[model samples]
Target: MSGIYPFLTPAGDAARDARESAARELVRSTAAKAVESLELRLRVLGTLGPALAACAAAMATAFRAGGTLFAFGNGGSSTDAQAVAQVFRTPDRDGGRPWPALPAISLTGDAALLTALANDVAFDVVFARQLAALGRPGDVAMALSTSGGAVNVLRGLEQARRTGMVTVGFAGSGGGRMAEERLADHLFVVPSSSVHRVQEAQTTACHVLRELVRAEPAEA
Candidate 1:
């Protein structure tokens, strides 16, 4: 029986051992990368200075005035926009002052409307058209773009500005045209070239801004 079973063979276990080793190495590498990205974001936070403060103030102003926040983006940025809306709408319910839920809408939430805008007009106007229809003066628009070169994201911010809404863009990799043209009232560029790093950092910034807005009254 031992011979037939190859003596509970060490050779049979080679594949499993190698696979486990590879998996462990991958986990270590990924964790290291995540920590590196987080460290970079922390450095950014320390030096962001008045720009971050201004963004917080603007967010607070919109909230105090009973204005809504509209977030829009494309691809991964679209998901980021939705996530920002979620955080504003749903707090953690942890031990803290129960704050009022801020109103935030993700423009990329509706597929039918997006498709219609793309098919009827231009693809670049998908977000711009939505902003024109739903946005009003005093509203805040948060535009997310990892590269910051996405035409639709820029167009959306431009339209929001034209519609008299305060525009804010979260971008990365030198902030592309959003940084170049100063299209938004506030623009934040995550200090990383990797899309994943930029995305994670932007989420942190958004959450921090939300907290500042909630605490603005006490500051004043």
Candidate 2:
């Protein structure tokens, strides 16, 4: 009688085992990279303190001078863009105060407008079209892209810049084309190649920016 193994193995047991082990090692390595990426983001946050303070000051100034905030993103990033807009539009529950005078719009929110723009013009014109219609000097355009090279995002940034709006880009992977083009007035780049990791950092950055804006003194 042959001894029975509890589990059945593939015909190429040794090769299968080796491949499985290699896969596990790869997973572990990727996990470690993700963790390191997060740690790097925390470290970068420390350096952002002074710059964020300056951004808050600048935002306050912009608001005082009567400006709005416009945000745009694609796919998952569109959700983040809307979330950021909500943070500005809604009242802060902890503070019990609302930023009533400050206008916050997400270019990705209106499905009808987006469809019309994409159909009538082009997909790349969606955000740019909205910016052209709504953006103004002293306003802020916050664009998010994990790859940092989305043509539509770049177009929106260009439109915002041309209209004199402050162009802010949140991106990943060395900031891609945006970094090359130097299109944004302020750019936050998440130093990770993994899409998941970059998106996580982008969400965190948006939350931080929202908090900074909320903490600022309301317009008198």
Candidate 3:
């Protein structure tokens, strides 16, 4: 059996052991990176306590005034935008008191409209056009951008501001043009160049903002 099976030989066994050791090391290194990223997110979120609270209060006020929330983004951020809308539209009931389902719409959800605008006009105007059509004063506009320089995202924020909506921005890489121009009424920057880590931190921020908004007492 030893002669027929390569794994029964000493050389084969050594090779197998080397492969297993490499795999273990790879897993260890990857897991360590993930842990480091998670710690970064939690630490940053802790440091942003006051800003988060203020942003939440603003959002809660908008909701109380019957304002709708419009969330938009591109690529992975688009998915995050949808997640943001879903979180507000159907809040989690796992906690002490269930949150009310707030009105939220994802600008990236309508493929037909997005394509129509992109094809007919310009890609940069897709979100801006949507806001012009639907957004109102006192409404909330939330946008996410990893580099914070997406043209369409910037345009959307501009439109929101022009329409008197409360603009909220989730951005990474030192907030890029979004912070430079002071576009958002409330801007949360993750301070990371890595897209994955930035998105993860943004997701945490979104959940925290939702909780804080829900905690605010609604007007009688």
Name the weakest run of 10 consecutive residues (lDDT summed) in model 1: 1-10
Cα lDDT of model 3 by residue, 53-171, tens digit:
99999999999999999999999999999999998999556466666799999999999999999999999999999999999999999999999999999999999999999999999
Q: State candidate 2's TM-score.
A: 0.79
lDDT of each: 0.85, 0.83, 0.92
As for candidate 3, its clashing pairs are none
Per-residue CA lDDT of candidate 1, range 27-70, in tens?
Answer: 89999998898897897777675787888888788778888999
Candidate 1 ranges with C-alpha deviation above 4 Å: 1-17, 91-96, 218-220
Q: Write the per-residue lDDT of candidate 2 for residues 107-212, one digit (tens) a residue.
A: 9999999999999899998999899999999899999999999999999999999999888888888899998999998888887787878888778777777778
Worst 10 residues of 2 by lDDT: 1-10
Q: Give the TM-scores of the predictions, in the order they appear.
A: 0.88, 0.79, 0.90
Give RMSD (Å) of candidate 2 vs. truth: 5.8
